[model samples]
Target: MANVSRQPICTLEPKMQNTIVIGVIIRSQNSKIIELARDRFNAGTRAVWNFTLRDSFNDFINATVWGTVEYVNKLFTTFTIGSVVEVINAKVTERKINDPNEVYVPSVTSPFTLTLNQHSSLIQMHNSPNTARYLKFLNMPTKDPGGATNLNHILNNSETLKNEYVDVLVAVTFVSQTREIVTRMGEMTKIREFEVGDDTTDQTVSLTLWESEWIRLADKWEPKQTILFLADVQVVFNEKAKKSILTIVRKTIITENPMLKETEELRFQFQRKPDIRSTSLYAVPNPNSITKQMMIIEITSRLNNASVLPSNDRMQLLVVVRAMVDDMNLDCDDPTLISYRCAKCKRLVSDEKESCMNLECPFGSGIKSPINITSINVLVNLKDDTGYLVGCRLRDAAAEEAFSCSADIMRSEFKIVSSTYTT
Candidate 1:
């Protein structure tokens, strides 16, 4: 590749041919290959890779490559994130603000998008002393943190901000495993859910990564270690759960482990663990976030308050209760010991059904085989000198651990072992 004169991103114009631009790859999504129907009987496959490039001046633009699967895949794999690459002979096009697809593009200072064609555009690894200037863009946020919304404010006023977009600066608190599922369009995709929190509040909020690029990047993120500045993230409402959720739409731009002063402040806050009780059954890594011991009467009172209070208004807390099992079915062979629920809608479904039964669910209607998650839904009644807690459900890993049995255990042997313990 010739060291052609590099052009600044701010000066790029539509229809500009034989253009050379040099920048660092701040963000890049995994290349996607899809089958395209050209005619009634003919079909072909095409691959596209999308990434964001930022110049030393902090001016960034969205770039896309469209070509055969082999060409796009090679380009995507060859140029990893943070690589300073030089683009030659690429075409620049004016961005159509009114285009629906434009919403998916990252918000950049530039008003144009770069298009790299297989036959014309060439990408070469840039190696020069000037590369240091572009490296700083890797950790710089596109937006200022002064105007970003706090996680506390977003959660408190979620109803008012429904369907709106907001900027946030948060640190990763937890990362969940990725799950693969088929969408309503019959396309298979993967999603991973993770939780983040900021100094504004002790409450942590869960966010999901739908794109393969973000998902892959999140795999390396460490809990309480990685700080992020998210721009233009959509606030969506899940009616079934009766709460607001932050979703990573196409307009969302995530800056991982930003190097801003505000991010350092946030990191300092994480270094000093908060004094909060864990409200989860799973073991928390932090010893400071331990569960409190509560009497049965206190537990019942808290449950009553939670039942009447709005979901958004409810306070989160974790506690340990000391009580004797008043009622339980130790017979593991009982069919009621295990239950299935539609993963998408959280609705109960028969074990024999292949799809969710809730017609309103996206995976419900016309879905021949909806995805479902199995749970060990065993109900146990506990009693203490103060009061009795009835129908307390023990599910998932907790249930398996309590009974010393797993889902794969033989029914007869599980029943015999379960009978040994008197509840």
Candidate 2:
């Protein structure tokens, strides 16, 4: 848990403020002294200063000053990169350098641009332990980052999209052919575009698979055909397209039909922890019985003791929800969230559309398997004595045991809201 602080989270905005701006100076550039005269009376040099400042929310803004010679130079000296400071009475102005048609968003998480007045005081607490106050807030467990994130979570979250690189699990919805395009330097290159989404989300993310090896993966991909592991992919929210965009780079790993059951289960556990108080909790296995028995634990957080965990094979963690994730998005109102997938193929199937997409599926396409055999993956959070992990997805036999009933009855009886924070 993070300590509470009354100090306001100061995000750089396009407005003048009389109060002080509190954040860390992430970057700084020295002001050049341009001399116009040799005489002592008015021979002083003019200086301009520019820098970036960030707050606890990871919001960043460019702060600059163009003023009388020594005034701007003084600010340049006081506010160095990585220095925490409180600037009293700052001015804000967007950089004219960026094109007006292009969005003003930073290529990174930064917010806007600002300028400090000559009279503004810079209170830099370099030696003090509170200097890195924002670091604590950043590390606070508001949410998990750095792991494979779903397209649904990315589309709904701006913070995750701001990440420089993210791993996403999505299925191919659309795929385009490789085409030649000239770069700004007039060099010819090949590129392809595709779309992908998951059951949790309605929107499809646009994927621009860049050449040279990535374009070859297109041959292996077909519409609604493959589950992909997109690693180290950069997400850019395209305003005009009204969807998140990503480009395949050399670092990106695009794996086809990867087995992600453990990954999916881990994510579900983290997202929504199982409720201990539910009447349906009868099926939950005894914590003591599973103590010596190991379940396959595939995912872990920093809080867990990795030394005891397995490296060669999957480890097991018998955990219950200490806290429940906000599941407003997956409540009774969204019937889709409570739906099911085929019994044999495990592909999603609707009452109206029961036929499986797989032609060679064991049950075969258009077989119309009964709805009772289908399944739905519910998201949850889980914790053991040592620590906790979020987004453990419970489904099938696991779901039945955790909920103390058939998957059908569990959906109708399971509570979306949780009251175990005190637990």
Candidate 3:
């Protein structure tokens, strides 16, 4: 913390292009950069040590402070994470180029690159305000996961799911014996995966642990230690297995902060259940708020129906599926269920249906009523405090509300052209 002698702090924003900003270093990746780039920047390595600074408005920027053998050795030497400092004449650079092939967002790792050179001034703040006071001054939104979904909910509610990290309360069921694997880059990395889940689901998702000098997350687990895997657990849908699995890459955070009551509850309530939910932390929802209202209703998260299984709630609700859209391509997974119908009668038919085949029906006589998508459905697995429920179907109006698209559009690649294109 730094003492500025009551000097006012300058708030940093994307709107301010080339300006010096003073803020607290709430996040730092100096060590990660050093480790990952150790081989690349081995001797006389000139690399940038990245750090994120938060201003009074809770606005944070990831700044890459360049380090060299002559000028600056490395970042975090004078200030660590949560240290306050005044950066003189910081310039915001363009976003780094990303692979266009990826359907996922560019990643939080890609932000307006903030760089500071040797000529720039770095003044550390010693008597900075406490977190309480800083928060008050920042006026940032309170961090709250009001409607976090469990594994059951995740498997069930597809609309509410986004590309960002998820929160789960999982109990590690099985830890595979450690193994060494080679990455695509020909780097030999030791890796291991384990199954974790809550009591609300059928199976557990996999969480991978890479080999590190100090078994970071693995060591954190005691004979049976439970903690919140706060964010960074990547949700990957295995198309072959037809289920979503979690990937704990290097960015994952495993912590048991007693201050977080939900995490404590998760820690204490964890049982050796085959299918359980893990309490993870996801700070925000997808920012996409676009929705359409009609006879259909959309619901997100879980309905908390753990007391029973194979349930259906007609509660038509509207919630932001939150595409988590950035200025990039949105994370749109293939819809779980597609609806098909007899083209002539508009009656529901299987996707493989060639004709109506009804002996008494006119369309069944000889007409080839190729099944067209009429409506799509989604299955929701929900959990309440009482118990867990699985295989709850969302159809008709509910699917329309949640997916923000008609059943026809959801089932096919064609969009609604116009009123003239109506079937």
On TM-score, the leading prediction is: 1
Better of 2 and 3 by TM-score: 3
Candidate 1: Cα lDDT at 41: 71
**Residue 195 CA displacement from its true place in model 1, Å:** 0.7
Instruction: Tell me the TM-score of each prediction against the true structure.
Output: 0.67, 0.28, 0.42
Best by lDDT: 1
Local accuracy of candidate 3 as per-residue lDDT tens digits, 313-399 = 232332333222122211134234665555434455555355556664345544434433366666665554433445556666556
Which is the winner by TM-score between candidate 1 and candidate 3?
1
Error of 2 at 369 (Å): 60
Per-residue CA lDDT of model 2 for 208-285, tens digit only, reads 655444455466664454566665677776665565667664334454555457435433432342211111111223
TM-score of 3: 0.42
Residue 188 in candidate 3, Cα distance off native in Å:
3.1
TM-score of 2: 0.28
lDDT of 1 by residue, 153-212 (tens): 887787899998899999877665566555677566777677788998878777777877
- Using lDDT as the measure, name the better of candidate 2 and candidate 3: 2
